[model samples]
Target: MTRGYIEGLLSSFPKLMIEGQQHTTVETDAVRYVYQPLFEDMYAVLITTKNSNIVQDMDTLQLVANAIPEICQFGSQDDIVENALQLLSVFDEIVSLGHRENIDMAKLKAIIAMDSHEEKIQDIIEKNKEKEAKLELKRKAKMFEMQRKNAAKAGITGAFPSTGGIGSMGDAFGSKNSSNFAEPEQSTYNNEYSPKPTTSAPATRGMQLGRKTKGAEMLTSLNDQVVHVSTDEHISVVVNRDGGLENMEIKGDLSLIISEDDKNATSIRIACLQDDSIQYKTHPNIDKNQFNESGILTLKNQTRTFPLNQPVGVLKWRFVGQSEDSIPLSINCWPSATGDGSCEVNIEYELNSVHMTLQNVIISIPVESGAQPVVGDIDGSYDFNRSTNTLDWQISVIDRNHKTGSMDFVINTENLNSFFPVSVGFDSSTSYCQVQVLEAISENQSVEFSSSSKITPDQYYVI
Candidate 1:
């Protein structure tokens, strides 16, 4: 009945219309007809019972007219089909279950947008907070810079040799720390270095360390070659016959400076990992109890004997494979900032299965001419401005197993070409893992090996 009445009224809408009228109503067959002009040739006809409000409904019709143009590019049926889903959503916001719900343009558009205003507001707030943190860090750095200039004028040498003031030092670095980022007392440094906050990312805003994900550069360098080697005393592994780990022996015997007791001494843990195969078998004595479910060998205290000063400490295990990689240490790098006449770099690394403490770890980064880099974020003991165009970083000792380290600093170079090779020269203390399987075991497997590492330049391109 309603549909029949609507069609009859719409058929005679042209005859009952008032001139120069945007909205009007007429009674036909004793049923009131309500409608308003949407376009020059199109109109929206609202069918209703006799009790429906007339004047108040014109307001609703006006809102519908206003909203249609914003949603439909052209006032035609084709435009409605092109944006059918959007049009339905907009229409639903104005009317629900064939009845009017809301007609206020502000609320209607907001509902149709489906955009979370709260989230957008939170993002703005976070950006402002990060900005303020960066500004505060700059302010402290400037204060230290001024003091260093004054000290230089007084002919002071080696005053505050390192950035000793306002330093972040603790086990909870990058884990937990003071958030307020309180100001520290003034101090002079021979260099322009500021101490990192003892807690979190307050100091390294706009610059971050660590890999969120691996890229082509990291993948290309992981195979066939990894760490750079400068000295002897590297670990060598031999795969026994029948595809079992036959022996793992340290080639060089050297004095180990152990800082902890016998119970807490560093011990190398070896896991057999292959690329093509997952179910590689191990020797019976291979510690399945400490074995990792991820198919990697677990080097534990009870499984095998890793003794100090025993240059040829052997472990009998083998698997059928031409290659095995136990990457002891891996570095991840990405460009953090492209500054005015500068480009900042952030570095992160993982020390995998490394059992012993690193006595002296020096990271060498090649720098170009007129490009000076200042290292920070991990007691950045560095010597730059070398004639060889290299930046030498002396980092602190890494003690904990599965340890990780990070640093953020900048090099003064334009955006054209900046990132260069970043390699570490740690005291190849005691032993480092080098895996290669041999079907026929022999003395020829014994070889002194070294690695040459580089960070590809594409990883640092900010654009």
Candidate 2:
């Protein structure tokens, strides 16, 4: 009968503990079963002795609850203990109120076992909380170690755990320390020879180091090679490759240091009035139309020819392909010339700023005239000189209107590369200008004076 009663209660409370309300009176003939031998015998003794001390009996019941396996199916011994204690607590109140007919000793003991059942539950909760706390501490410790390693990699010295508290975990990763990681300081990596900034550009290092993009320098060099409005003919310069030539051609990058004063000057110009050849690539034998397919194929030969330098202006060359497209492949010829070693007839004159008058100052004369002078249209000059010379000289003016007698000459080691020396003096009485000429004489070449100043004192004579 006791086993039957226990089974019936177990069926109602599928879970170990039954948290519910039951009303009305009930009676049963109970049969007991012993899954735990000692606790089951203690419980049966309490039931047989109708006047058992309920608190002492409830304590024994709780011991039974604790002995039950944690993974036991729902409504096992522990749950039974909890629910029985609760029901007995209510039954004691009922018996005290004189409604004791439904009271049973086993049920009363089960109800009083609530304290022990709850104590066991509290122990389990506490254990899980302790484990979680330990895991959290481990996580925090690993994060701190990572931060220290990162700081060391960044070369920061004396870094220790912060008493002020940790910063953001995200910052401790690769982000905040990235800039300092394995990087030299700006002051250190920079060129030590770089000139300090001043009003003028730095003579040694004109541009800042590390400021140029990866491919910018190469692009800029190619851009500079593009021709834009050639004003004068090409000039001669040293044609040596910096690192010797190979494969009948030069490779590797080279730069020509041009003076700021001559940056605007034309790269090419006529060397003399005598007909000199504009160099070109020519092959006497090989023509493009009849390639190697023709029998007895003769390779082309190259020669230089003189072309008339009529257009007194500059021309630029933009490189395309250097070879013929079809099978008769021949390499293109490039001009290996520079203006660095060339010379120019740089003319300088001092004029009276106040007078604003025109004076025909003789710039050059006949040195011997095997080579005639070539002149472009005289670009107007600022500030004119008031001349006092009474002696007039004949000036050779080219008639550009007829398009004849016009001459252009380039300055070189062989030609008028040497500048004509000019001397200027003032006459106080007439406010006239007096001029003397300086001549360039080679050991073999002879020079002569052909023109003189045209300005006299009549114009600027103040009454």
Candidate 3:
């Protein structure tokens, strides 16, 4: 029953044309397909989430259209139109019979929306036809005398009367498609409408072919990765992928850990899969050529990383963005050979230790599966190494000793050299520190040592 309904739905949708490429598809359940009519002989498709089965069939058509926009090169425009009409017809049949029980108010709304969108598409297509007619008229006025000669060359089969104008052979075959010898010269810029702008802008030239577009809806393409985050206040994004990780697959729940010292001082640690990459692309509903600050950052949203073997990297736990009550973060990912690697980062901040003004600083830590540490208490001597300016807290630890686990340290950097001699602090100027976890597991459940860290430096350091 579901299959039949799907088939019916697909049978009703129109075939979308972009350039010469065509898409006649029903898409799938829980999916949205957009056909934008661009300039003459041009169109585009925006396919959003879909059920697995539908994705396979629809993706094939999408890949072809994306690779080459000239759909008519392989077949006639009539063939493309017929394909679309057949699909839409099937949809009409299904809706009429009511085979699917889930068809309710939402589905009906979508159908109405689809109808409205198609109407707009048809309007664009008509506009393009009118523009094509004007260009054809100009072509007809060019060589009035050569009409009979070209008519004779084209033969009289289906060749309507030329009316004694340039409308002889050129009208039958497109001016661009004119026989190599008889074709007239073309200028660098013809009046032909440049197809509708990509998801980056609005239609500046009124030419419309037959494609799906988005005015404000989410429009996108395959293989495009991005991160969308809304913290109930400010929205932030990071949209670049190059010498960086690309495949960003969110397996489970992830979050941001923030610590605040009163209302003024705040520290943040974003504990997520670090080395993921996403293709931040422009929203399909928008145009590519329009001047929009929105589009400028559309392609690059957020950057987060985590290394597989090392467990962490430079920016694993750093300040992403600040808020009144919380901090926001985002990341993108694409497929990579390194097993979707990322870097884990941790940031520690201690304030006013000299005066000890701020007491009871609240610390927040977001733990991941297979990565939580067993907290252990240490009983040993605390000694300050003035020679190396370091503080050493020695403790006795053993495997299966009922005391193997992780520990958190709160220390000040300024007084390090005063008691010991190292550079460590709780201020913004302090460099990042490493947190090491030592565990003892038997050969049956062996002990392993792993570590992760976060750091801060001038942006120039990367260069």
Which candidate's TM-score is highest? 1
In candidate 1 the C-alpha lDDT for residue 313 amounts to 20
Q: After superposition, which runs of candidate 1 have C-alpha atoms over 4 Å from their true positions? A: 1-325, 336-339, 415-417, 433-463
lDDT of candidate 2? 0.26
Give the Cα lDDT of each candidate: 0.44, 0.26, 0.27
Cα lDDT tens digits, model 3, 165-266, are: 445546655564445323223212212212232243223444446855532121121002111111111112122222222111211111111111121111
Candidate 3 lDDT for residue 237: 18
Model 1, global lDDT = 0.44
> Stretches of candidate 3 above 4 Å error?
1-107, 110-114, 122-126, 143-463
lDDT string, candidate 1, 186-205, tens digits = 22211112222123221212
lDDT of 2 by residue, 347-407 (tens): 2222322222323322221111122223333333222111110111112321222111111
Quickly count the clashes in candidate 1.
12
Q: Estimated TM-score per prediction? A: 0.27, 0.15, 0.18
If ranked by lDDT, best first, what sequence of candidates would result?
1, 3, 2
Pick by lDDT: 1 or 3, better one: 1
In terms of lDDT, the poorest run of 10 residues in model 2 is 250-259
